[model samples]
Target: MPDFLTLANHCANPRQGTQPNGLPYYDGQGTLTEEMRWLRSFIDEGYLWYKEVPANLNMADYKTVLDYFAVLKTPLITASGQPKDRFHFTYPSEVWEAMSGAGVTLGYGITWSRSTGATPRVYVVTMVEPDSPASKAGVLRGDTLVSVDGADATTSTALAALSPTAAGQTHAFALKRGESTQTFSLTSQKVTEAAVQNTRVISTSTGAVGYLQFNDHNAIAERQLLDAFTTLKAANVSDLVLDMRYNGGGYLLVASELAYMIAGPAATDGKVFERLQLNDKRPPQAPQMFRTVSYGLAPTSLKAGVTLPYLGLKRVTVLTTAGTCSASESVINSLRGIDVEVNLIGGETCGKPYAFVPQENCGTTYFAIQMQGANNKGFGDYADGFQATCKADDDLDHALGDSSERLLATALSYRANGVCPATPLRARSSSSTGPLQLLRPVGKEIALRPR
Candidate 1:
């Protein structure tokens, strides 16, 4: 096989210049078939489950490059009966750059919760980014989506309308929250995300408990976390509830920093937070150590040499769901590795200890399981995901960070007492609803991150 670079940069629509990330494009003599071959060889060499990928998948049988790439992943199943390699996919390189960098995207800025594999689908807004189109329209959490563009929300046509298109494309949405129904003609546009939100000190009888909704692990997250930690430090909060139910993960280092900030130097100063283990054919990797100081990495973060504020707590409560993935899972596992108890609430995390550095070739960025992660103790076998300590529905009726919210309240109660409630909360439903549903993000299915 030829070197992968020899077959790269053969875009059908070859870019005219460099991208916003300053990646330069070059001309290539490569063809579509050569590009496909490059991918086949790349996967054979780099994928963690390289041996499980079918040996007989002839590239000629596929029509499009995407179709060929789709069938290249392992067909193996996990012990949990789920597909072992569900996180394989690709993205337009530019789109990934914006998201991994500043957490910006084109959308209504509403993270919705949809009932998976349930008939007569029900979708609810779990979060609305402040100042975005969804928030400007006064859309709130707990608002059940009834219709899109006058069609039933469950229908394929209506659901397609909600897919991201371009800025200024408008769609009508009918939603019901409790007894009141509201409709919105919302437009899609570039929405800069607030990676961390709803940060506040919840004054409990036990002490000041700090809580913050962390939605992404992008570059901007570093600064926001520093600011949030600073606030929590000033309040001297005794406990912390990190809400990561919708975070799909980003940079691995950002996750390590979060773990350090939670556990502090006493627990993590000399320990590894997470170690990336590549496939058998690859070289050994250096473990990702717990970061102690801030580099002011984000475009708008504090200047270099600023010390990070840590909670120095031995225990932390994390709010989670299946939408909590990759780097988010790393934070939980790493904290637990150092014997810093992570009491989880909500649902189990999306089981994915694997990560891959995005590789851009021919204008597309590819994601594959190149490495699996382990915590300090070198244990990384939670494929089915970390189970919740207290099973509580995400209470959308009360805004996130509110003390009455189910997940936060449960965390508070669990900390007060070392046990879960007798009966856990479930998503509220009327007789008209289907099986009990849990809050899951309507955004990307898996994490987009590096290890």
Candidate 2:
């Protein structure tokens, strides 16, 4: 393969100016076909399973660049019989940048979870964004979607038609919430999703336990986390129930900061939060340390260099599910690395110890696995996902952060008595933010569950 670096930024319709980083685009004479070759070279060199990718496919057989990318992934399967890599894909560079950088998106802010088998598949409201139109329309979490625009939206095909694209796009949703049925009109708009929600100090029998539903590790999450930790710290909480059930994941830096906040200086002072190992061809990169201070990422009031607060707790309870992934798992893994007891409560995580450096060429940004990560303890082989210590059902009946909610309640129970529940919950539905949909799709990260 030739030097793919030489063909970098040589766009078909080149931008004539500098990027936001003040770096000029290395735009040279190029075509779509040339861009594919550049991507091929990059994958051949950097992809984590570079040797596993089929090398015999002709590039001319692909119609679009994205089509080519879809087939360029490793076809290996995990021990659990799941696809080895479902998280490989590309998107418009602009969309990825906006979402990961600022948690920005154009939508009604209703996160969905689908169940199948019957003709009329059930679509449940897994989560609703704070202050979003769906929230304003009184769309509660766990509401079963009955219809879309007065039409039955039970089939998978019908679900595909309910895409929220442009702002001002209006749609009516008929939902079943318990015994009652309600319909609401919602206009799609630009939604700036918040990372932390329902943060509060719960007075448990054991002690004041802090509960916070962390949805993603986007940039906006930095300040929100600081605020939540500050609140929990000020309240003198003895334990924490970090709800990451719906969280996919995002920025590694945010995860490091959060780990430090939970375990504090005594445990995290010199500990590595995540150690990234690139492909065998590349030299080993430096490990990410637990950050005690903020980097002051944008869309927030938190300034850089402020010493972050710490809970200094020896044990932390993390609420998990199949949707919990990437950096979220990093938090669980790193906390365990420092001997900080991380009691998990839900289903297994979305197991992704792998990550990639997003590379943009022409108009689309591509994500291909380039690294496998381990904690300071050097144990990172949970690709099948981290299983729960106490298996709990995702309760749609109770509001999140409510002490009675299944996951949160179970966590509180375990703290009171050091044991899991007698019975495991068989959930009726699970989160359905498949490989194709995720929040913060730009970076080497993920989310439900959102975006």
Candidate 3:
């Protein structure tokens, strides 16, 4: 007899269907009957596991077990939330990672049909890029995803199962827009945004400094960072003031690149970038490291080395808030490991350190276990949430004036005279185009936000 999981895997990845139903029919050869019995047992075990879930396990652990079994049997459903059990599991974390990694804009907005009278739905939009595959496939805003391939994914699990590999995989999406339901096929492609997001820059009021911000890191974060550096160097900006107040973490490599850039290229000669510790608390595989090239010690080259590079930052003043999370915190914690000046300000950050990767089981999508420990400087679990070194001291309604104004002002003071000022920087402009102007000038309390 085949192993339980082996049979399950075979069931999930069956041979070509002989007829209308996608399932393989039972011949008297006994293979089909035995497979069916194994599948039944597998389902029964999963039910038992779900029912026997330990009370002591945290939500994350509980979720992991539930997810492991879901891969064995993915349930499919139709557009009206109909049960379409032809598919496998749904909501496998890997699907979420792959979709987001492919540069899709994921948000939790209420998706409703007029007939359903507003049941909560997760709204996914394929925002167009200059020349991406999604744009090429004619996917646009207001287009609702109904299913991937022939699998019905009307629920969160179904949605997660649509994770496509790479940017070039062909994805068939059944969608709804306005009042019409339709289907379209498109090759997954990376979206390139003209605006920069999660990039690092340095301007000098007295000396070199840091200035970084990002619109999104899903696609071209690495490119944006390179561009920002080139522009800042040309403009003779010094030091650095990283602006990640709006960044939601995306590709892990991009975050690592940012860390390498800020750390320079010399300090990271075969050093750890960060570690991923599973719950078992075993020492993570050797910390992933990156080398730097050009500038500082090696040569005054803006280009970085293929291997380890510099990892030195005199002082880092990270401007953050609640929007900061995951890869964002990874970059921050990595920098802190080498003793970069991390003046955390603005607000608290969302704590998520587990890195995720996708693995498919017979089109029943799932995530591979790929997270690490939080010993980035032995400063304890950075996931406990890093509080602002300078917490805001004003009311919530006055958020703009209180949090940002105060944070930026203190950062400027520290850079200018190595100490915070008694008063906060006043606001100047609030125009969407003028982000830098929103904060007071780097060295002085000159309100820059447009009125």
Which stretches of candidate 1 lie above 4 Å from their native place? 27-29, 295-297, 300-305, 430-451
Candidate 2, 326-368: lDDT as tens digits: 8899899999999999999977888888766677787687888
Q: What TM-score should be assigned to candidate 3? A: 0.51
Q: Residue 262 deviation, candidate 1, in Å?
A: 0.7
- Model 1 agreement with the true structure over 1-451: per-residue lDDT tens digits: 4556556676555667676867667745567787798788789888998999999999889887788999989998877789998888888877877777777888898877776544687888878889999999999988989999889998987887666678888999999978888999899999899989989998877789899999888788889999999999999999899999778777777788889899899999789988878889889877889988765557466555567889999999999877788889989999989999888998888888888877888778888789889999988988888899888766778988888888888888888888898987876742346323444232244433443
Give per-model CA RMSD.
2.3, 3.7, 14.3
Sort every candidate by lDDT, greatest first. 1, 2, 3
**Per-residue lDDT for 1-451 in model 3, tens only?**
3343555444422434342234543222224443444434444343212223332332233233334344433244446464322213234333433333333322221111111123333333423344555556565544655776767655655555344435556656776665776777766544334325333343344765545555344433444566676665555554666766545565555666667876776655566776655333234365656434322111222334434323256567777754566667777787777767678766666555545443333334333223533435644264445776655321111222122345655666666776554443322221221112011101110000000
lDDT for model 1, on a 0 to 1 scale? Answer: 0.81
Question: Any runs in candidate 2 off by more than 4 Å, and if so which?
Answer: 15-29, 116-119, 155-157, 426-451
Query: Please, what is the TM-score per model?
Result: 0.94, 0.92, 0.51
